[model samples]
Target chain A: MRQPMTALERVHVTEVGPRDGLQNEERVLTTAEKVALVRALVAAGVKEFELTSFVSPRAVPALADAAELVAELKDVEGIHFSALVPNLRGAERALEAGIDSIVLFVSASQSHNAKNVNRSVKESLRDFEQIARALEGSPIELRGAIATTFGCPFEGNVDVRAVGNIARHFADIGVRYVSLGDTTGMATPPLVSERIWHLREVASGIEPTLHFHNTRGIGLANVMQGLALGVDRFESSIGGLGGCPFAPGASGNIASEDLVYLLTEMGIDTGIDLPRLIEAAHVATRLMGRPLPAQVSKAGPRLALSDCSAVPTARG
Target chain B: MRQPMTALERVHVTEVGPRDGLQNEERVLTTAEKVALVRALVAAGVKEFELTSFVSPRAVPALADAAELVAELKDVEGIHFSALVPNLRGAERALEAGIDSIVLFVSASQSHNAKNVNRSVKESLRDFEQIARALEGSPIELRGAIATTFGCPFEGNVDVRAVGNIARHFADIGVRYVSLGDTTGMATPPLVSERIWHLREVASGIEPTLHFHNTRGIGLANVMQGLALGVDRFESSIGGLGGCPFAPGASGNIASEDLVYLLTEMGIDTGIDLPRLIEAAHVATRLMGRPLPAQVSKAGPRLALSDCSAVPTARG
Candidate 1:
C-alpha cells in the first residue's frame, strides 16, 4: 500500500526557477523582471529559493545579473535564499551578497564534472575544501549538491560510491543538507531508493534533498518514492522553466506548481498556496512568451470546473 | 518504502490510441494510416488494444472507419482487440466485426452523461441491460467504463459511493472488467486508492483498468498509486494523442511510452520494447504533424548517451 499521508504531513519545497531554470534559456529576463517573478512566487507563499548562481557571466549569460537580482531580494522577510557557487570565488561573492546560505556543487561523474567546469572531480573536491574552509563560522549556512548523481550524459551509469563519496565529503565538512541532482533526468525509483539507503550507510546524519527533472516524464513518480521513504525536501522550477543544454528537447527541472499539486493532493502540507503558485506560473509563461511544460498550470487546479454547454461532447 | 518489483512483476498495459485518442482529434485519419499506427504499436509488443469505437460517423468522424480497422487487424495473432460501443446498435457492429470485447461507457456524473449522450445515468444503465441481454451467451466479453470517475468538470468532487455503484452494476451484469476513467484528468493518488478500495468492497470480483489523463501532469504518479495498491492493468495512448475537447488545453491521456518507461525502470514487467515504443511515438508525431506531450520520446531513452563535443555544458 502507499504510505498514508499521516506518516509524512509536511514537506519543504525549494523553488529553483530563478537559477537552474533560467540559466539554460536563450531569452534572458532583466533583473527587474526576475525580481517580479520571485515576488509572484513569494505571494504564493514560497519561502525557500535557489535564488541565483554566482557563476561567470560569460559562461551562463542567461543569469548574468545574478548578483543584482539577489541584491534586490535579500531583504525579503522570513525567506531562505541559497545561491549556487562553483568555487572559492563564487562562494566569497555569495557570502558578501548577504543571502541565507551558499550551495557548493560538484558532479559525481568525472566526465560531467570536466565538461561542466573544465576540471577533474578531484580538483573540484579540493576546491570545495577551500570554499568550506572560507565559509567556516560564517552566519550563512553551507550546503552541497552532487550533479550527475543519477546518470551522466557523457558516461552511461554513475557508480553509487561516486555519489556517496561527495556526501561523505560534505558530511566531513559539517554540512548537513546534501542534494542529489538528476542533471539529465536519469533518476528512477530503484536508483533513488538505492542512493538514499547508501547515503544512510555512509553519511547517516546528512539529510538528502531530491532534485529531479521531468525529462523522462517520471519526475513526480520519483517524488512518490521519495515520500514513501520519508524524504521530504525537493527542488522544482516555476512553469518547468529549464531544459537540458546537453540533451535537446529534454526538460530540466520538475515544475514547481506540479510538484506542489502532487504533494497537496496527497494531503501533505507544504505551506504554499496552489492558486497563487499557478498565478505565478502564468506570469512566468508571459515572461517567456510561450507555454511551459508544467501541466498543472495549463490544466488549472483539480477542482477548476468547466461549463458543460461550452465544451464539445464526444461519444467515447 | 516502495513496493519491491518482485511482488507484482507483470503489469498489463492496454493501448487506447485508436479509439479514445483519435475520437477527439479534428483531423480524420484514413483507415490505412490507422492500420499503420496499430502496426507500429504491435511491433512494440502491445498485445491488448481498445482498437476503435463503433459510434456514429456523424458523432465522431475521426473513428468513422471502426469496422474497417477491426477488419484490417482481426487476423493478427495473439492480440486482444476491444472496441468502445455506446448503444445496442454499436455493440452489434462491434460483435459483427469479430472483436474480442465491447466497452460500454456511462459518465458517473449526471450532467456529463446528459451532455455526452443526452441521457440520464439510469437510462444509460437500462440501455446497458438491453445490450447485455442482446449479447447473452455470446463469446465476446463485456466491459464497462464510468467516465468522470475522479472529479467531474461541472461537479467538484465525486463521491466514492457513486463510483462503487457503477462498479456494482457492472459486476451484476456479468462484467468483470470495469474501467475508472479520469476523463478530465481529475484523478489524484488518494482518490485512486480510495476508489479502488471502495470497489473492492462493493464489487470484489471486478478488476479495474485505470484510464488517466495527463492534464495535470501527475498521470504517472497516479499509476504509482495504482501499482502500490496491486492494480496491474492500465490504459495509455501513443504520443499522448488525445485532448479533452471539454477542457481546452488539457491533455487527454497519459503517453504509452512514458508509462512503459516508468514500469521498466521500476523493474516491473510490462512486456514492452521501449525503443520500439519510442519509434512508434515518432510515427505518431509525424502522423499528427506536430509535437505531442510525451516527455520520454522527446528526451530519448535514459542511456542514449550524448556526444560531449556536440553539446553545451552548464555549471549548475
Candidate 2:
C-alpha cells in the first residue's frame, strides 16, 4: 500500500526556473523575458519562486538583472520571491535589492563544494557565520542547501552524516529551511528516505526540502520518498529545464507540470495550475531556444479528457 | 524510513524489449541483432524475457519473426521466454513454436479494446475463454494483462472495480499471473497502490505485475509504488525504448538500466548485472540507428566516481 498522507494536506513548491533553470541554458533571457516568465508563474498561482541569483554577473551572466528584477517585482502581492546568494556579498546585494528571503548553498561533498563555489565545505560553513551575523535581527529569511547530499561525482556514496553535519551547522547559524541536493542525480528512493531519516535524527530544527535532477529518471521517485516522510516542499524547474553543467548529472529538473500531475492526482494541493505551468514551460522553451525535457508538457496530461461522455473509446 | 525488503528477497523481471520495445521502433532489427540483444540480456543474468509476439506480420512487421526468434532460442537454458498472443490462433502459433509461456492481453477500457484489438472489453474477455480452452491441457503457461487498468484515453478514470473484475475473470479462467498495463501512463503512486490493493482481494490467486511507460515521467514512481506493495514482478524494455505508438501515450518504457539502478540500490535482487544491461542498452541504441528516450543511457549511471579522495572544502 502507498503511504497514507493523513498528516500532509498540501505540498509547497519552490519554482526555481528563473535562476536554476536559466543558469544552465546556453541562451540567456532578456530582463523583460525574465519578468514575463516570473509574472506568468505568479499568474499560475505559484506563491513561491527563486526569482534570480545574487551571484556575480561575471559568474551567472544570465541573471544580471537579479537586483533590477527583484526591484521591479518587490511589491508583488501574495508571492514569496527569494534569491540564491552564494556569499555574504551576494546576501548584501539581495537585501539591497529588497529580497525578503535568500537561499545559500554548500555541497556535502568536498570536491563538489570546491568545484561549485571554489571553497571547501568547512570554509563555506565557517563563512556562514559572517552571513548569519550580517543578517542578525534583520527581516530577511535565510535558507541553506547542501548539494550532493545523496551522491557525489568525486566522492561516491556521500555519508549522510556529512550532509547532516552541514545541515546542523546551517541550523546553528539560524537557518530554518534547508534542502538536500542531488547535484549528480545519484538519488534513489531508499537513498532519499535514508537521508531524510538521517536529517530527522540529526537536525530536527531544520525544515528539509528536496532538490532532485532527472538525470537517470527517478526524480519523482525521490520526491515520492520525501512525500512518504511527510516532506512536501520540492524545488523544480518550470519546463523541467536546468542542471548544474558541472554537477556530474544530466541537465534536467523534475518538470513543474509532471510534479503537479502527481500532486493533483494524489489529491495533494499544490495551488499551482498545471496547464498554466505547461504554458510557462512553452515560454521557457522559446526563451531557451530549445525544447525542454519535461514529459507531461509534450505528452499531454495523464487524463486530459474535458468531457468523458464525448470521448470515443476504440470499440468501433 | 524506506520499506523493509525482508520477504522480498528476490524480484522477477520480464525483459520485454524484443516484442514491446522493437514493435514500436521505426528501425526493424535484423534477427541477428535481435538475437544478440536477447543473448546479452541472458548473459547479464536475465532469467525471463518476452522475446516476441504472435501477432500477425501485417500488424507488427517488426516482430514478424515471432516463431523464428523463439525457434532460435527455445533451447536456451534457465530462462522463461514468453510470447504475447492476441487470440487462440496466436496462442496456437506460440505453442507450435514450443513457447513455454504465453501472455494474452485485453484492455479494461472499451475504447482502447476497440482500437487495440478491434473488440469490446466484453468481447475480448469472451474471446479469452476460447484461448483458455485451447490452452487448458497444453504445457504452455498462460498469463493475462489488463491494459488501461489505471485510466483510459477515451474514458478518463477507469474504475478499480472495472479492472478488478477483469483480473478476477482472468484468475477464474485459470490464469495465475496477471499484469496491469499503464497503457496511457495514467498511474500515479496512490492510484497504482489503490488498484493493486483491490487486485489483491478480488484476484487473490493472481500474481500481479506492472508494465509502465515513462510517458509523463512518473513511471519509476509508479514502479516504486508497486515495490512498496511487495509486487516484485515488472515488465520493462531496454534503453527505455518502446511503447504502443497508437496507444495514446509517450514512447518510452521505464529503462531497464534505470530500473536496475533503483532495484540494485534498494538491495532488491534482480539477478541481472546493472552495468551489463547498460552495455546492452548501448547496443540497442546502435541497432536502432538513433538514441532511445531513456535518460540513464545518455546521462549514464548515477554513481559516477572518478577520484576517491583529496576533495578540498570551500575554505581558504
TM-score of the second chain in each model? 0.95, 0.92
DockQ of 2: 0.39
Distance from true position, residue B227, model 1, in Å? 0.3
- Which candidate number has the best lDDT? 1
Docking class of 2: acceptable
| lDDT score of residue A238 within candidate 2 | 87
Question: Which ten-residue region of model 1 chain B has the weakest summed lDDT?
Answer: B307-316
lDDT of 2 at B310: 21
**lDDT per residue (tens digit) for residues B63-152 in model 1:** 778888899986689999998888898899899989999998988889888888878988989989999999999999999999999989
Query: lDDT by residue for model 2 over A11-41, one digit each (tens)?
Result: 9999888877787677888888898888888
Off by over 4 Å in 1: A1-3, A245-249, A307-316, B1-6, B245-249, B307-316
**Residue B218 in candidate 1 has what lDDT?**
94
Highest-scoring model, TM-score: 1
Task: Give i-RMS (Å) per prediction.
Answer: 4.4, 6.4
